[model samples]
Target: MFSSIKKTTQKLINLGFQDDHANDVNQKHVVNFSYLVFCFGCFLLMAMSLIPFIPIVFFVSFICICLAFIGLRCNYLGHYARAQLLMPILKMAQVTLLTLFYFGSESGFHFLLLHVIAYSFIVFRADQGFTKGIIVGVSSLLFLMCAFLSLKGVYLTESKQNLLLVSVFFFIAIYFSVVINLVMSRLKSANQYLRVLAEKDELTGLSNRRKVLADAVNIFADSVINRESCVFAIVDLDHFKKINDTYGHEAGDFVLTKVAGKMQSVIRPIDKVGRYGGEEFIILMPKTRLPQAELVMEHLRQTIASLVIETDKGIIIPVTISIGLAPISPEVTRYEEILAAADKGLYAAKRNGRNRVAVSPDFQDGN
Candidate 1:
């Protein structure tokens, strides 16, 4: 039952928005606020209909409903500025006119203008300072005007005035609560997106150098304490600069992204792969010795060598990678030492030939 209600609510919130705007946070917020206005307008119209109908009160409720429809239509047409402007205007008019002529100050209708002021800040972007200030100033002036004019006389009986006072206050409290909660939820989602951008490579979508190094340090420490084997390898694309110069930078980028994906697919779940920098990557294999790492790196080298990348101009480019492997030793005191050993082996592989894996001399004797 709860799931059905949630789906129905989602459909209403997405009403009138195009499918392309499904991920737009600001657009969703506008639709939700407009829907709230429409619902409240309906509530007021029904409540006034049930009571001893005053023509003025009924007229104001009907106008509120009409303005809400206008707001929704503006948002649907992508006129966000107009829709935002309408919301404050609608609230200010409803509260001020209602307080001035009928409900009066005793009914607390003027307090709803506070919501109008708060809504302006939430809906307007930070760059819209002038527009936001104008909305705030106008709403404030109208609030004071209602308070002063309401002192003249109230049309409703004392009992009816008290009941309306409670209802208006309750509505104001609920509106502010929902607004605050929505703001907090959006903030959390934005922070999470920022964290991912900081730690991951934008182009290749792999762990970046900083994150990879941090994880390597932690994994290395654990391996030492637990007496487990760990292997570190540095992989570099062979003749990558020539590929960029011959085909084009776009082709080079495509090759890099595809190679990263292929490496990820071949590695074990316990292994970690990251983009160390331009044309270079790092792989960490936990609980794997030098001989075991050699087989894995050799498979990766063959896999990359077999890759065929077709460019936009219909040129086919073949790619290859050279790898350097270093295993954790008792003599290794820090993660940097292991990394330096791997660097040495990478040079060895490059010197001998490309598209091959080379093991560090320090580990060759032991393995």
Candidate 2:
């Protein structure tokens, strides 16, 4: 039962969000708030119909429902800026001009205008300071106007007026609570995305040098303590600069992204692969010895050799890689030592031939 309720609520919140804007946080918030406004309009329409029917109140409720529908339609059509401006303006007009004028201040409709001030700030981004100020300033002035108009007279009886005021206050509290929760949730998601950007390579989508090295340090320490074997391999694309010079940087970027994806697909889940630097990648394999690591690197080298990339200009490009492996032995103390050994092996591989794997001489005797 709880699951069904959750799913239904989610559907309503996502009512007007199409696939293009599905990942947009601000668009999602706008859709959710628009849903709330629709529900509010329905509630008002039903309540006013059941009570002592006032024609003007019923008309206002109907207009609210229409305005909410129009706002949602605008969002569905990807007119986000239009929808954002329309919702607050329509809502403010309905409350301050219509409801407050007809039902008087006793109805508590003026309180909703105050919520519009905060709502405007949430919908507009920080960079949109001028537009945000205009919306907030207008809403504030309208709220003050309502406050002054409240002293004129009361239209409904004392009992009806009290009920209406309480209901309005209740809805206002719920609206603000939902808005605050949405803001906090968006902030958390934004922070997580920023962290990923920091740790990830922008071009190839691999772990950056810092993150991979950090993991290598911890893995190295664990291997030393448990007397386990760990392999560190440096893989460099052969003649990468030549490819960039011949095919252009766009083609170079395409090859790098494709190669990174292929390498990630071939490596074990426990192994770490990171873009160490330009045209160079680092692979850390824990609990793996020299021979096994060599075979894995050989497979990766062959896989890359077979890859054919077609550039936008209809040019075909084939690539190959050289790999160097260094196994961590009991004699190894720091992770940096293993990295240095790997670098030596990489140079040997490049010297011997571009498309081969070389093992560090220091660990060759141990293997």
By lDDT, the best candidate is 1
Per residue, candidate 1 scores C-alpha lDDT tens digits across 1-367 of 9999767766655565643322356435644664575457556655865567677777777778877787878777777667767777777787787788877777777888888777777777778889889989998988888877775444777877777778877777877776777667667777777788899998899999998998899889999999899999999999999999988898999999999999999999999999999999999998998889999999999999998877778888999999999999988889999999999889889999878999876777644
TM-scores, all models, native as reference: 0.89, 0.86
Task: Give stretches of model 2 more than 4 Å off.
Answer: 1-24, 31-35, 97-99, 126-131, 151-159, 225-227, 246-248, 312-315
Residue-wise lDDT of candidate 2 within 82-101, one digit each (tens)?
Answer: 77777777778777765555
Q: Could you tell me the C-alpha RMSD of candidate 2 in Å?
A: 3.1
TM-score of 1: 0.89
> For candidate 2, what is the TM-score?
0.86
Candidate 2, after superposition: displacement of residue 260 in Å?
1.8
lDDT over C-alpha atoms for residue 316 of model 1? 87
Lowest-scoring 10 consecutive residues by lDDT in candidate 1?
Answer: 18-27
Off by over 4 Å in 1: 7-31, 34-38, 151-154, 157-159
